[model samples]
Target: MTQERVAMIRERLQQALPVQHLDVEDESHLHVGHAGAKDGGGHFRVLVVSDAFDGLAPLKRHRLVYDAMGDAMRRDTIHALSIRALTPAEYERETA
Candidate 1:
């Protein structure tokens, strides 16, 4: 189920953005017993590198990610998302 959810998230982001690099990690286990966890939604962290975020501010970048996620958020497929949205240059600089 986790793998399927991750694939779904990756697919949605790829379809909505020009994704150069993407990684999705399931962290649902970290939130065991939490209120939101009771609903069976998973917690995830994503690192997305794309030219689409070139000049966008952090908030805008997050918004783009959220928009890409679409109904997964509302439908409880994704309860919490920790996003790291960046351009290729930013990703390189950070990794370096």
Candidate 2:
């Protein structure tokens, strides 16, 4: 189920943003037996590098991702998401 949710989120972003680099990690295991996981919500982290976010602010980037998740958030499919939204250049620079 966690993998499915991650796949859905990744697919949505790829289709909509065409990211240069995308990484989705299911951190749910780290939260096992925790409150969030117990409620059917999982902890995940995402790293997305795409020109689509070139000029967006950090908050806007998060908003875009949350928007894409839509009902997933409401349904407790995703409880917490840590996102690093970046352009290709930003991602490369950070990794350097």
Candidate 3:
């Protein structure tokens, strides 16, 4: 189920943006027994590198990521998301 959710998230983001690199990690186990976890939603962290975020501010970039997550969020499939949205250049600089 976790793998399926991750694949769905990746597919959604890829469809919405020109994704250069993407990683989605499930962290639900770390949050077990937490209040939000009671609802069956999972915690996830995502690192998304795309040219689509080139000139966007942090909030805007996050919004893009959230928008890409559309239904998953609305339906409670994703309870919490830690997002790292960056342009390809930014990714390279940060990783260097």
Candidate 4:
């Protein structure tokens, strides 16, 4: 997908999830010459901080984001996503 589409997706996710911090990085350059890039989709890294992730296991948090991405993954609009989800408390502790 185009960068605009990726940005839009990220924006929608941040709005819906109301995260304290969100970073969406496109890793398309790393995937250049790979088979998936032929379709214009690419890899991504998502870092998110939210109270909603409190009490959730790491796998559950990742699952929540994958579910939110929905058809984008299935259709190869997003080839791969690396997610780092943190609750507000966790984020503060890490930064401290």
Candidate 5:
């Protein structure tokens, strides 16, 4: 179940963005007793690097990710999502 969500998220992001790098992690175990977990929703963190986010504000970047996530967010398959959406240049600077 955990891995399935990760795969689904990664695939969805990849399809929506021209990602240079992507990492999706399941953090559900850390929030095992959290309220959302009871609803079968999972907590996740995603690092998305793409030129698509260039020049966009952080809020907009997140919006794009949420939009890409689509029904997953609305349907409660993803209860919480921590996103680090960045352009390729931002990624380079962060790694540097």
Candidate 6:
């Protein structure tokens, strides 16, 4: 289920954004009995790099990602999303 959710999320984000680098990590197990986990939704952390976010404000970037996740967020497949939206240059600098 964790792998499936990650795949689904990766696909959705890729389809919605021109991602240069994307990583999705399932953190549900780390949550254990947290209220959201008990409700059956998954927790995920996403690091996405895309030119699509080039000029967007941080909140707008998050909104774009949330919009991309559309059904996953709305349907409870994703309980919480920790996202780091970055442009390719930003990613390169961070890694450097």
**TM-scores for all predictions:** 0.97, 0.89, 0.97, 0.86, 0.96, 0.96
Model 4 lDDT, full chain set: 0.82
Which pairs in model 2 have colliding backbones?
none
What is the C-alpha lDDT profile of model 4 across 1-96, one tens digit per residue? 467757866876776676898888888899898998887677888888988799999998988788778787877578888899999999899999
TM-score of 3: 0.97
lDDT of 1 at 7: 97
**Candidate 1 per-residue lDDT over residues 18-89, each given as its tens digit:** 999999999999999999989999999999999999999999999999999999999869999999999999
lDDT of 2 by residue, 2-89 (tens): 7798898898778777679989999988988898788889888999888878888999988887787788788788888899999888
For model 4, what is the error of residue 48's alpha carbon versus the real structure, in angstroms, after optimal superposition? 0.6
Candidate 1 ranges with C-alpha deviation above 4 Å: none
lDDT of 5 by residue, 1-96 (tens): 888889999999999999999999899899988999889899999999999998899999999999999999977699999999999988999999
The candidates, ranked best first by lDDT, are 1, 3, 6, 5, 2, 4
Which 10 successive residues of model 5 have the least lDDT summed?
Answer: 1-10
Query: Candidate 4 at residue 86, lDDT?
Result: 95
The 10-residue segment of model 3 with minimum total lDDT is 68-77
User: How badly does each model clash, as a count of residue pairs?
Assistant: 0, 0, 0, 2, 0, 0
Lowest-scoring 10 consecutive residues by lDDT in candidate 2?
Answer: 65-74
- lDDT tens per residue, model 6, 53-87: 99889999999999999988977699999999999
Q: After superposition, how far is residue 72 of candidate 2 from its true place, in Å?
A: 1.0
Q: Best lDDT goes to which candidate?
A: 1
Off by over 4 Å in 4: none
